[model samples]
Target: MKPVENAEGIQASLTLSYIQATVLKAKATLTVGILNGAPINIGIVGQADVVSDGKEGSAGLVHTDLLMQYDIQNDQFDAFLKATVKVIIAEAKVPIWLYFGANTPIPIGETAAEQKTRQSQNSNFDYYLYVGCPDGNGASRLGDAFSKVKVTIWKMDAGIVSGSLYGEAYFCIGSILPKFPPLPDEINKFLGYSTQSSNENSVINMINQGGSASGFMFGALVHGNINVDLAVIRAYAKATVGFDVALLHVTNPGSCQVGTSFGMNNWYAVGQVFAYFAMGVDLHIDVGLFSGNVTLAKLQVGAAIKAGLPNPTWMNGRIKIVGEALGGMVHVNKSMKFEIGEVCVPEMDPLASIKLIAEVGPGTDNVSVFAKPYVIFNLPMDNKPFKFNVMDKEGHETTRTFRFKVDHYTVKSEDNGYVGQGTKQFSADGYTMTLWSDEAFREKMKYTITIHCKAEELINNNWQKPAGKSEEEESIAFTTGIAPDTISERHVVISYPINGQNYFLKNEFKGKKSMVVVDQRNDKYFKLENDSNPIKKLTIIEADGGQVINTNFSVNGNDILFDLPGSLKNSTTYRMYFSIESSKTQEIKTTTELVDLEKTAGTGTVSMADVDFSTVSINTSVNILGASGSGNAIQSPTTTSASERGIRNKAKQEQSHRDAIDRFRKGETPVMTVINEGIENGTVDPTKIQDGTTAQGKEVAVYQPATGRIIYQMILEPVNLTPSPIKWLPLEVS
Candidate 1:
């Protein structure tokens, strides 16, 4: 075979026909023959026989073994073959025109319709890479290359005679090179193509590149901290490309597995497989899916009963429990049928099954009342309302106020409980809670109180229903005594200023001027039987002069106190007159002595015998007969006329003096009489009471009745007397 002179390619097409009667056989083979040397056989072609009928020809089979040594680099055959095909038929050489060319369309025996239909199917030429050359060359290996062959069959043009056949073959070198162990970049790209390939590096890269892996794909991130297997990734890269090249060569050989399953796309599964290989442990991550059931592991409550005072400071109580741990459990199951985002609200109805119950006391047990009682609880979770059902004697009350305190952290509601009123809401450690009744119990009344809660509805603590009963209860019964009002005045008596005692006027008393005082003792209450102030008014009198000393009543009704004048004498004897309710004006006599530091040192130990003010008189001898010559003179008369009128005037003055002294001794002082008369006439102020006339209101003239002449006119101004400190000298009543 050879090329035609000036022809662009080899012979356009090749066709052969034989008209034999019954059996026609054909065979073709190629041998390279040197110019003057023996022919060298490179390949073989087996004979093909045809059995034809007298009417038409029948197709036959021809088997051939052939190899064309070619250099793809130069687009020509090897030097020994000289880019030609020498075919010898039946040992008698037969000339065959075969050419390798630039552009040529091989032809085959098929109609235009058949060719169009096949073309419409979009078929591709089958390719083959012979591992070992048919001429006994070695097989291919890694990084090795020969040539790639593409064989295609097509029909000739109808104008060129239909049903005529031709064959086409394509060749390229090094394009079919075999390279094993894919590069890391190629492996990364393959992994990035699928979300399931969540190797730590692959997942992070994908995520950084704005790709996502959801569901079980991200489970590894939470389960094992995003563990990945580099070896598995390497193997996957190699196996994937190897299989693809094998399929290109039309063969499929079993390969190694990527861990256990081919679904390496599941990150959790991949992590599990890697985990097993690294540590021999299979991981089962929760993946934020729960079975939607919680069990009650433990339940404990406070005492069933408690006794309290009429107005107890605090009532011990509790509603505590424990349950199964619900860690990392999501609201939905793995199947993802439904999703609940809102938490269940706790029950807050006061009359509901879960509440604190305060039963009614005596006299109206049949009625129901809702009182706003105060309560405390040790609920360490949410700060939600804790309801209570209060059944008082009457049917009218508000919901209870509850304060939940946990670990010293107090969550007070809009209204505070009794626990907030100076008492502890929670225990020292903030676990126990003490409740208090809103109001003091009625006197001598029977009452009962109970606390209850439903464990299942405790959503604040994430508590759910258990298999059995979930309601917890505690109760207590007690009867109250007489009301606090009555008890306040019982067992109390006045214990100050004994009937007959002597007291000293201490210098300190001048500052306070509060002489009469009620005793500060539990048994010395100053309240009247009707709970009113016992003291109506107080009156103090100079015992020697029988003159009343006005006093002021204490403003505080709970105490019996009196404010005396600030002008009291040190060595005077005084009498306290108390006008008390349901009693007479009681009188207590007390003699006062000047404050003696030594004698007063022992408080409440001063005796009347210690100071003798009555027997020691600084009068007669000292005033009338002493050497001082300050003698007592006769009382002066009202007036005088001539020389002898002096004696008569003196006699009248003495008579006037005698009459005045007599009247004063008989409980009628001249000033007192005048003041009383003026008071009766509504002309003088009754509040002013003084012996010496100064100026209280309008001046009145004094008349010398013995001489029938008007004397001097004067006014009176009262003076505040300092009180003497009265020390109680309790003595035997007998």
Candidate 2:
């Protein structure tokens, strides 16, 4: 039959005899046509090894072998293949069309219309059209022919357009075709093409050689094509610039295998790339335009470009003392020093030498000294020590004992006394002193020190006794002096006199003293006497009889009942003494000695009776004549003498009364006695006077009263006088 024409100038035709012989591989059996085009042949290949027999001469055909053979499959493969084939055919130069008819027997020359009618009456008939092509090329040609055909076919029948061919023809074709090998040079280019390329094997091999070289080459190639489809060289240059700008250019690059697929494997490599170059390159390539599906080669190229950039380092230097002086007192007399060992700088070049300038004081007079500040070149290096000079304010260079040493790059300055004596002396009463060494030595050695003053002499050679006295006496004149001593050297001596003997006093008072006295007195007290008053009072006095009598004194009382005298006669030396004496009594008359009367009890005692008087009254008259001759014989009592005697008698009587009252108050009995011509007598009354009553309107002495109550009283008078009315009477009851 003649082929039909489609809009694209493609044709479609079918023969029943060709369908049976080619698809079924059977001898000519039946021929019939139910439509204007050939029927499609859908075959399922269940195994990868299955080969399609070209005898299936159907114009519209699809195979499902590839999908069925794979352990895992997805609809993507199916869809991709279907769309590819449909597009290829739709774009061809010829138009082709086919159809199926009922399974009715007909001769090979039968027309399409006649076949269709014959198959209409038989519902059980299944028909297929043979387009006379077994190979893909021939089938493709047939499809090209249909492209020009103009039959009104339903859009639903366009299986290729809808992607249903993915499960049938596309997958089947993939299963039959041989997989391409990888190529290193054209990997990225090959992947760029829509159709599979010949260099696949070479590309995969390059990916497997994961390293800087492969990463750079592959990544550059891939990155360029995807980037803007720019030239590979241009893309590489752009990426490198970006890496530099970003400061991410890696000095070293590395690569690794990330993953693999059915026909393609993925590789991953990373390295720092310059942000500037990468950015520029990416912009040129319009990388953002691409979807997320980028090849590993592109990423590796970007990373490698980043690896070739450089970063700069910053550094500075400085110096300072690590440790301070122990006491913080820098003295000139001792070794004043510090260490250069603590000097340090950061980010310094290991191979470079450090330069340090050390100044001790004013630049004008001071000297600058230093040793080569170079560290040793060793595998593991240490700080280097260099000795520098220390200058004084006056610019004088002082001597030092210790020095600094650097060995094996290890720097250290030891405590060398050479900087100075390391010892200082200060007058006990002087100001703080300072001493230091030359600046040169100081820079080399470091030291901390405690300052101390030398002890002053407690007794210097100039100490001497005052002159004029014997050595023994003069020795007492020596005194103590102040001095500071090293804790180990404290000692002192004191000299003074004791009694007549001279003694050297030793370290007695170590600290400050108010005064020192030396006394030679045997006794501390003495008696004072008037040569003319042998019977007078004696007095006690303090002795002023020593060379050391610098102290003062005074008398405690004027009355001298007894005397205690201090040593007298300073040069001769007399001892202290004491004296005692008594006063004389008056004469008494004879007959008044014996008398018995009621006695009164004293103030302090209890009384039993009223008046069994022991009160005495005795009168005795005697004539007073001049020693030469009696100037006048006494006749009657003259008022003059009488008055005198009365006064005297009154005084006497009052005294006696007071005495008696005192005795009674003290709980003692009052006694009345009269002694005459060498005879002493008194009267005692056992049961007598009453307790005394205090007299009113009578003057009584207001002396400090004794403890207890008054109990008795007594009265005495001369026999010649009349008794006055009793001003005070005693109670009679016991």
Q: Per-candidate RMSD vs. true structure? A: 51.6, 58.9
**Using Cα atoms with residue i matched to residue i, what is each candidate's TM-score against the true structure?**
0.17, 0.11
Top-TM-score structure, candidate number: 1
Off by over 4 Å in 1: 1-427, 431-478, 482-580, 583-734
Q: Whole-model Cα lDDT per candidate?
A: 0.27, 0.21
Q: What does candidate 2's lDDT look like per residue over 619-640, in tens digits?
A: 1122212212122322322343
**Which predicted model would earn the best lDDT?**
1
